[model samples]
Target: KKMIHAGAGVVDYDYRGEVGVVLFNHGTEDFEVAAGDRVAQLVLEQISMAPCVEVEALEDTARGAGGFGSTGVEATPAKRARAEAAAGGAAMGAASAAERTPHVAGEERAAAAGGAEVA
Candidate 1:
């Protein structure tokens, strides 16, 4: 059973202040935390920022500007199996680090992921 709802905490690089953690209790009973009690774990990771460039127009694609569920795909067992098969039995067609490519869209991307055709 889940008693607490803890989300990822992000501390900016240039913020000089006390780090605070927000914990949400999802249980009916009351929860208590004493001094020096371990409520969560923190891991420091380095992130990189890429330069942003302005473009006049974005590339045209079949699924252009389509967000989640824009392709009208249902998460069915049979469809999932087909998707897995198309991805060489890989889970969610996730590519290895070396084979990672930029976000693909439109028919090609869907076909590669074994997703349903987008209009």
Candidate 2:
């Protein structure tokens, strides 16, 4: 078995021949394990196998149309200033989520608030 650590308490396995145990640290503090230490014990067993076939289909969703950074990034100074003004005028209380909700869920409201045509 090939063992790889993705994170604390998380391990990936590529089992081939013999099985092995992976001991992981779940806590923030570091710990140690010595050789021959009992990380885990295993028993060998025989199993029967059979051939099988599987099929799958692509899925869809409303948000599927958008992808990473679909929204504008690195806003220009003017756009930043306009967004700040709109946010302050609406008293969004320093919460970006509050300002972004309408943009994401209500195009009309977001466009009206930002003095732009809703596309």
Candidate 3:
């Protein structure tokens, strides 16, 4: 019989002998494994290999050498500035949600925008 732990354990691919698993219980209470329990699974796959080649220079393109969230990224300073200005010009009084229903969702910002009111 194989002994496989519930937590940190390893079974390397090079092992050719009969295997045993150690059942471990790293829990707050007692753990049990009954008959016909699917305690473990096995997977077989093929590992691909490729030879490395040396090159003199790597070709460059638009947004060259960019990786890790830097690709196609934009700062959009103008849009950010307009949003900040519109948000900054709003009234900051403590009004209840029921009392502000007539103003609608975007009514306050639309009223503050001079001519962008809806409904």
| Per-residue lDDT over 1-119 for candidate 2, one digit per residue giving the tens place of the 0 to 100 score | 22423233322244556545556565666666689765564544565466766759546775567898865475643355367686675343323433554344444334334544333
- Residue 25, candidate 1: Cα error in Å is 1.3
- The 10-residue segment of model 2 with minimum total lDDT is 1-10
TM-score of predicted structure 2? 0.25
Which residue pairs clash in candidate 1? Answer: none
Clashing pairs in model 2, backbone N/Cα/C closer than 3 A: none
| TM-score versus the correct structure, for each prediction | 0.57, 0.25, 0.30
State model 1's lDDT: 0.64
Q: Give the distance in Å from residue 26's predicted Cα in candidate 3 to where it truly belongs.
A: 8.8
* Model 3 residue 112 distance off true place after TM-score fit, in angstroms: 36
lDDT (0 to 1) per candidate = 0.64, 0.49, 0.51
For model 3, the stretches where C-alpha displacement exceeds 4 angstroms are 1-30, 33-37, 61-63, 72-119
Give a tens-digit lDDT track for model 3, residues 52-115: 8999998987568887776535423334335545777323322322133333455553443333
